[model samples]
Target: MDDSALLQFSRQILLPEFGIAGQTRLSDGCVVIVGLGGLGSAAAMYLAAAGVGKLILLDDDVVDLSNLQRQIAHDVNHIGILKVFSARDRLLALNPSCEVVAQPVRFVAHQADAWLAEADLVLDCCDNFATRFALNQVCCSAQIPLVSGAALGWSGQVCVFLYQSGQACYRCLFADHPESAATCSEHGIMSPLVGVIGSLQALEALKVLAQVGDTLHSRLLLFDGLHQTWRTVQVSADPACPVCSAADSP
Candidate 1:
């Protein structure tokens, strides 16, 4: 790391657990973030500012006026443009040295391998179930850690799936999709709620990258914005889980 880069991240480097070594690891890490809305905005920006070497941004949606309420990585000038590109602009602005690969397309199964190639970690910030399930399956198969987060209607949740032996993958927690999964638009989301969850996702990602301190591995963190309370539940691997179980079995 150069003098300028070191000074730029001196605050993080000052942390006992996240010293220069951890900062170096972050500078050599690559993370794939699938979404550019509320959650993705915070995670991407924080990761970039923390000096993650590279970020693969995946999102096909265009920035809309409504997003200005919570998506901090975008602005009025970015309206009508692809979300990935908008986010990439902001990320680069935060850390020009950070390589931001903006893929203006939705995550698809056929292209999963290509999209996830060389990824040290992945952040599931997308709102829908299909993408979450797909990300969980791919991460499990590849043994890549996944930082999963969700926020809607004043409630948010975060979890880290290490995808290691005997560890739980996302499918273990949600065996089946919710019969009526709500979106931020439909159910109304608390703007700051996503920022809180997304920031936590970025924190977990940095811990996983630097191999420093304990992370949310195999644990579910629940945040109640309305009541301003928090709770954590241990998540166990589902023996009959279709995704992780199949991947683990011979």
Candidate 2:
């Protein structure tokens, strides 16, 4: 790295766990973030600022007034812009050296493999069950690590699936699609709650990318903001998990 980059990431590089070697690993990592909402906003900013070399941001939605409450990346000034592009601008503004590729298209099963093939790590920052399930399958198939996070009302959760390590996939935990997943518009979320969870996603992503520190790896972290507590539990692989039972892992 050049003196300029060393100075740019001096604070993080100074850490014993992260020194120049970790920074080099981070500089060579490619991350895919599937949403630009509250969680993605925080994750994207931190990942870019942390020096993830390449970021692929995907979102088919546009910014709205309601999102400003927690979606920090998109400001009032960015209203009506496609989320991926808006987030790309914000991430670039934070770290111009980071390559932010904006994919303003909804990710579906058909595009999963092609899009996720080169990802070193994937962040499931999108809302909705279908997308989450699809990502789990694709990441598991590609043998990539996934950093997943969710926030609703006064609660949030974050987890990492080391698919390459035979860890549990998301479907192992959620076998059946829920009849309904609550939305922030209907349930109301604390602004900082998503930040907390999203920051954890960023932390886990960096840890995985740099191969430093411990990661969630088959563990689920539940955060109860109403009570200000966090608990982690083991997530065992389901022998009958249709998605991962006879998985195609790379």
Candidate 3:
């Protein structure tokens, strides 16, 4: 690492476990953000600020006037613009050295393999359940870690799926809730609620990337902003889960 780079992340390098090596790992990692909404905005900003080398920002929606209320990365000037571009600009302003790739395509299966194939970590910040399940399948197939977060109406949840040998995956936790999933647009979300959950998602992603500290693998974290309380529940893998169970079908 050059003096300039060292000077940039000196605080992170000062840690006992995260010396120059951990900083190097972060600088060499690539992560994909699957949405540019409230959760994605906060998560992407923190990820870039923490020195992830490359960020793949995937979102097909355009910034709307209403997004300014909660999507901190997008401003009034960005209204009608593609979200990925606006988020990329904000992230670059935080750390110019990080590479940001903006993809303005709807997240779909046909394009999933190419985009997620080389990612070290993937963050599922999308609002709907279908997108979450699709991203889970992709990450499970690629054996990449996924940091998932969601918030709607003063409530939020964050969890990590390691795709490790014996850990439970995302599909295992919510196999039956796909039909009842709610969107921030329809249900109304508290602006800062997403920031809180998304920030935790970013922190989990950083830990997974740097290989430092324990992650929320196989455990679901719930944040109730209305009541100002938190809860954690352990999750177990389903032997019949179509995604993770496929690994043993051979």
Q: Each candidate: what lDDT?
A: 0.94, 0.91, 0.90
Error of 2 at 65 (Å): 0.7
lDDT of 1 by residue, 1-250 (tens): 8899989999989999889999999999999999999999999999999999999999999999999999999999999999999899999999999999999999987799998997999999998999999999888988889999999989999999988878889999999887778888888987899999999999999999999989988889999999999999999999999998898898
TM-score of 3: 0.96
Highest TM-score scorer: 1
Q: Which stretches of candidate 2 lie over 4 Å from their true place?
A: 248-250
Top lDDT hit: 1
Q: What are the per-model numbers of colliding residue pairs?
A: 0, 0, 0
lDDT, candidate 2, equals 0.91
lDDT order of candidates, top first = 1, 2, 3
Q: Per-candidate RMSD vs. true structure?
A: 0.8, 1.4, 1.2
Q: Give the per-residue lDDT of model 2 (tens digit) for 47-159.
A: 99999999999899999999999999999989999999889999999999999999999989788777787799999998888899999988887788899999999998998
Candidate 2: deviation at residue 165, Å? 4.9
The TM-score values for the models, in the order shown, are 0.98, 0.97, 0.96
